[model samples]
Each structure stands twice: as structure tokens, then as C-alpha cells.
Target: MKYHVVTLGCQMNMSDSERVISVLEEAGYQWTDNEEEAGVIGILACSVRQKAIDKVYSRIHKWNKWKNNKNLVTFISGCILPDDHEKFLKLFDITFQMKDLPELPKMISSYGITTPTHLNVGIDPHNENIEDFWNVQPHYQSNFEAFIPIQNGCDKFCTYCAVPYTRGREVSRPSKDIIAEVALLVAQGYKSITLLGQNVNSYGLDKKGEELTFPQLLREIGELGKRMKKEFWLYFTSPHPRDMTDEVIEVIAEYPVLGKQIHLPMQSGDDKVLMRMNRKHNMEKYRHIVETIRRIIPQATLFTDVIVGFTGETEEQFENTRKAFDEFKFNMSYTAIYSPRPGATSHRWVDDVPLEEKKRRLHQLTEDLRKHNLPYNESLVGQTVRILVRGEDRKEGFLTSYTEGKLTIRFACTDKSMIGQFADVKITSASDFSLEGELVEVAASC
Candidate 1:
């Protein structure tokens, strides 16, 4: 039997899908990209936004329709809130938490689909750490890039977020396991590795004395990188501004393995809006973190996430967000239009910002980003930088690559063999978000 897993949402979802693929394939299901060809379908979904949830309903509706003509089973997991959970349980053939991944085979065994793992599963409740799930090696989808989930769940209950409800409280993984995984990936020649979490900086706080702190974990990884004699870029995502410390920035600056790109989310620029969102830190605190990053890692390309409109956001309040674009001069910003979802604190409050006004703010911030980003890319013109050649670009005769700072680059190349290798490229032209370059040199395997 063949299976297909549809993934939606963040890099963390993509990472989770990799592990899901391993479980399905181990249970004797061949992996397939074509949903029509598969007897089993699974979705590693995201519930952060309404649009992602809409896609989930559309896909499952279509997948369920397939059951009338053929034998099929479907499953769902990842970032599902309590409200959706009650409904999804009735919709999917098997609905289970990520921590219960080891029981997947046993769950599907009722349909006569069986595996060795299923035989071992006898209905004991899973451990809180999801250790069995962690033990399952991910069937990495990329030759040069990979995602390593260092931690699971969220502790910070931001008013607008459903992560605390969906993922539960924060739980840090055993540092030994994480180090072992990273060491193995590097030994296998994987280059681009990202550490994923809802709030990455808060890692190890739950485990305090048991596991290494986020900075300590990075220091170990940095030391490992030095000893491995490998060329790779390490990154982490979506850390809360509250947990962000100067020590973390110092650690990053000290480590060459740590990527020069940082994704710090400033959800709103206005202090009142941030307060309403339950983001503990104010504008003054967030600005300090940004300033620290600038002073410590001057060459780093800064990225952020911001919400355009939240409940009770006034016109003047939105203007502060607009002004933040100018103050920060962010190389990139993921501007989101806020939508109230069930199980979140914000959902209790009236969604005061009009949809059209949210769009206007989002557009305004995007234009500001272009203005800021163009100059950074333009400055790279004529400079030779090493990039991890990803794959062929959509444009004919061009290939895609990324700098250590994770800037996108496209350059003309006929040798597709260099796709997974590191190469030097001289920037010839620049666009708002990406760079066009000329191939200069090819280096070691990524």
C-alpha cells in the first residue's frame, strides 16, 4: 500500500511530516506524492490561521469522498486546538496526538493493516516527553537541508495564539538525543539544519536542571560543528521576544555554525496592542533585543513576524507598527492579518480591526520591507559569497541558492550536479527579496 502525507503551516510541520513518512513507510506503506494513488492519507496540519484550517477542511472533504469507491484510511495531527480537536476526532479515521505516534500502526491495525511495531504496542499511555516519537528517525526530504525538533509545545500563552491549547505546555527534549541527531546529520553531509519550536528561545526552561539551556545547547552544537569539520548553517525559529536574552546573541556571534539569520517576532509595535496580545515585553524591551543583535551580529539579516491588526487596535496604534518598519529596517517581515480563532484569549474579545484596514497595514509594511531589503541586497552587488545551491530555479537555465544569512539567490547554471553542494557566487544584480548572481566557485558537499 502507498501513503501520502499533506503538510501545511510552518517549518515545524514539515519536520513533523518527515517523521510521519518514516512511520508510514516502516508500517509497510510506500510513500507517494500523488494523493489519488494512495490507500492511506495523512495531514500534518496547522491551526494557527483560518486559511490553513480552511485548506484542511477542503482536503479532508475531498479525501473522504474517495472512500466511497476504494478502501482508504486517513489520519490527522499537529497544532490542532481543542475546539477543532472534538470535530477532527469524528472526521479522520484515526486522530492521535504527536506523542502517540508510536501507536499509529496499532491504530490502523483494526483495518487489517499491520506491522512489527503494531505487534509491540499494547495500549500503554505514552510518556510526556514523546520519547518514542523522538526515537523514530525522520525520513529527511532534503539532501542538503533538514529540520531538527529540539523541543515540543508552548508555555507562553499569547492572547492571540492557540499554541498553548493545541500543543500544551513547553517540554524540552533530552539534550543528549538532540546532540546525537545533529551529529549524525552532519556526518551524513546534511548542511542546512533548523531547530524548531513554537517559541524556540524558551527551550529547556521546562526541564531546567535536566536539559541544557538554549544557549548551552547552541554552544554544544557550535563546538560539535568545530570538531565535525563540516560546512553547514544552523538556525532556530520564532522565539518569543520576552525570552530572548543578550546571552543568546553573544552565543550566536561566537558560533560560526549558527546561521547569520535571526527570525525575531515583534507581533505588534504599539505597546497597548502588545499588551492586549499578552506579549509580556513592551516596545522598549523589544528594541533593546534588536539593538543588541545589531551591536553583536552586524552582518546578520534580521527577520520578524508582525500582526497588522488585533482586537481594539486604533488607527494611531497601527501607525506605530508602520513606523516600526522604518525604525527596524528589517530585511524581511511576515506581516499577518489577525483573525480570531477558538481557544485563544483574543477570541473572547471583539475583533475590532476591519479586514480592509488590516490589508492596508499589511501592504504598507510590505512596501516598507522592500525599501529596507533592496538596499541590503544591493550592497552585496560585486561581493562573492558562499551559498548552498538548492535546486533548479523556475526560470530556465537558472539555479537556486541561499547565503548563510538565508538570502535567496538565483544564478545561471547548466551543471545540475552542483545542486546539493556549496558554491561561491558573485552578485550581479539585486531585487527586493532575492539576488541574481553569477557562479564563481564550487566547494565541498553541503
Candidate 2:
């Protein structure tokens, strides 16, 4: 059988899709890029946004119409809500939770020969068997960059997020397991790796009272840069404001292999909103943390996640968020118009803001963020930044690479093999989203 998988939501979904692909391949199924040409279609979905869910509905409708006479089977799973499950069942041929996925080969085989009589109940597998998921070498889509999920799920249970419900509580993989995986990737010539998690900061909290903590995990991984004799870049994503410990910051500051960019999430700038969301940290506390990070690592670039137009957010509250952004001078910010999520504690509260107002606030916040980022990008001009060349630019033969601080750079280079190597590029110009540069020199081979 042939399959095509569509994934939505966070990197966790992307990681899960990769696991699905590995399992499918092991089960003797081929893959096709075209969904229309596949014998089976798998959708790894996200329930966080209403729009994302609607898109899944639209795809199911389109595929249901096409599958009436066709022999295709459609599967829906991953971060689905109970309400969405009912809707999915009406259209999809099979709907199951992601945790129950290891037994998919049997289900598929029985269905392929003759439909099984018994219902397939969802079962939580032993996540400690990290090898089951991380063992198979992934068919990575990118040659130079890869998303490595070091952890999964969020324990914070922010009032407005569905991650806690859909992905379950915090779970950290064994530190040795993670380092071994990274070492293998480094050996494979992968140039960059971004550790992924819902809240990467809480990585070792699950293993509390154990010897292998988060800082220890980072120290172990940092040592790999010396042990493997490689200079490839390392990074992690979406750290919660509350979990930025001094040790993590110090490790990043010390390890040259670790990227200089930090993507810390500050969901709201108002202390009241944060309190309501159960963020556990106030604006003052967050500012102190950021200040400490800058104090320790002056060159570190910072990115943030902000949500505007939350329920009951007043003009003054919104202004507080803008002021915070201005004060921090974040290199980049992801601002979103707040929308109520199902199965969240905040859903009962009225979503009172008008759509136009929500959009306006989001725009104003993004514009304010640009005031900081534009200057930072402009400052890069004339400075040589180390970048890992990833691929060819779509518009031209110019090569594209991502810098140590996670900025994308477009520069002209004659050597196509440089696509998987780190090279120094002198920044010539910059824009809101990208940097234009000229290749300076490629680093010595490891």
C-alpha cells in the first residue's frame, strides 16, 4: 500500500508524523507525495486552532467524495478533541489516538484482508521505550536541518492551551538516549539540530530526584561537540518563561555548538492575564529572567511568543504587552489573536473582543515588535555570521542557510555541496524576514 501523510500543529505533530512514516515503511508500505495517488491517507491533526480543525474537515469532505468508488482508506489521529472525533468518524475510515499507534500494522493487515470484528481501544504505550519511536532513522526532509524532539507534552496546563489535554503531561527522554541520537546525527553529516518540545524547559522535571537532570542533560549534550569533534549548530524551541533556569542559560552561553537564539514564550505581558492563565510568573519576574539572561550572555538573541486580545483584556493591559516588547527589544516575536480553545479552563469565559479589534491589536503588537527586530537585522549588515547552508533558494540559484542565531540567510555560492556544511557569510543587506549575504569562507571539514 501507498500512503501520504499531512501534518498540522506544533513540531510534536511533525515528530509524530515522522514516527508514523517509519512504522508504515516497516509495515511494507510505500509513500507518495500526492495524496490523490495514495492507497491510504494519514492526517496528523491539531485541535488548538479552529481554522486548523476546519481545514481537516475540508480535506475529509474532499477525500470522502473521492473514496466512494476508490479503495483508499483515510486515517485521522493526533491531538484531536472529543467533539472533533465525532466529526472525524463521520468522514474518516479509521480514527485512533496517537498513543495507540504501534499496533497499527495489525489493524491495517486485518482490515486489508478482512475487517476486524473487535473494536480497537486506545492504549498508552510505555514512553520509556524511547527506542520504539526514536530508534528508526527518519527520512528527514531537510539535508542540513532536522527537528529532534527531546521531550513531549506540557505539564503547566495553561488555562488557554489544549496541549496538556491532547499531548498529556510532561515526559523527558533519558539524557543518554538524547545524546546518543544527536551523536549519530552529527556522524551522519547533519549540520543543524533543533530540539523540540511543548515546554523544553521542563525537560528534567519529570525525572525529579534522579541524577540526570535537565542541566546535566544539556551538559552531556554539550560535551558531544568536543567528543564527536563536530561544529554543527544545536538549538531548542518554545521554552516557557517560568522554566528558564540559570543552569540552562549558562550552558547555552558556554557551549559554542548551542545556538545563540532563545525562543522563550511570554504569552501575555499583563501580570493579571498571566495569573489567570496560570503561568505562575508575573511580568516583573519575566523581565528579571530576561535581564539575567542578557547579563550572562550579552550576544544572545531572543524571540518571544505573545498573545493579544485575550478575554477581558483592557486597553491598558494591551499597552503593557506592547511596552514589554519595546523594553525587551526581542529579535523576533510570534503574536497571535487569542481564540478560545475547547477543553481549556478559559473556554467558559466570554470571547468578547470584536474580530476587527483583535486583528488591530495583533497588527499593532507585530508592528511594535518590528521596531526592535528591524534594527537588529540591520545591525547584522557588514558582520560575518556562521551559517549552515541548507538548500537552493526558490527564486534563484542562490544558496540559503540558517545562521547560528537561527536567522535565515540567502547568499550566492558556487559550491552546491556546501548545502550540508557550515560556512561564514558576510551580511550585505537585511530585510524584515531574511538576511542577504556573500559567502566568506567554508569552515575546515570535521
Best prediction by TM-score: 1
Instruction: Please give, for residues 231-254, the per-residue lDDT of candidate 2 as tens digits.
Output: 888888878878888888999888
RMSD of candidates 1 onward, in order: 3.4, 2.9
TM-score for each of the candidates: 0.93, 0.92
Regions of model 1 farther than 4 Å from truth: 112-129, 442-446
- List model 1 lDDT by residue over 265-331, tens digit each: 9988899999888899999998999999999999998899998889998989988987888898898
In model 1, the Cα lDDT at residue 230 comes to: 96
Report lDDT per candidate.
0.85, 0.79
lDDT of 2 at 115: 47
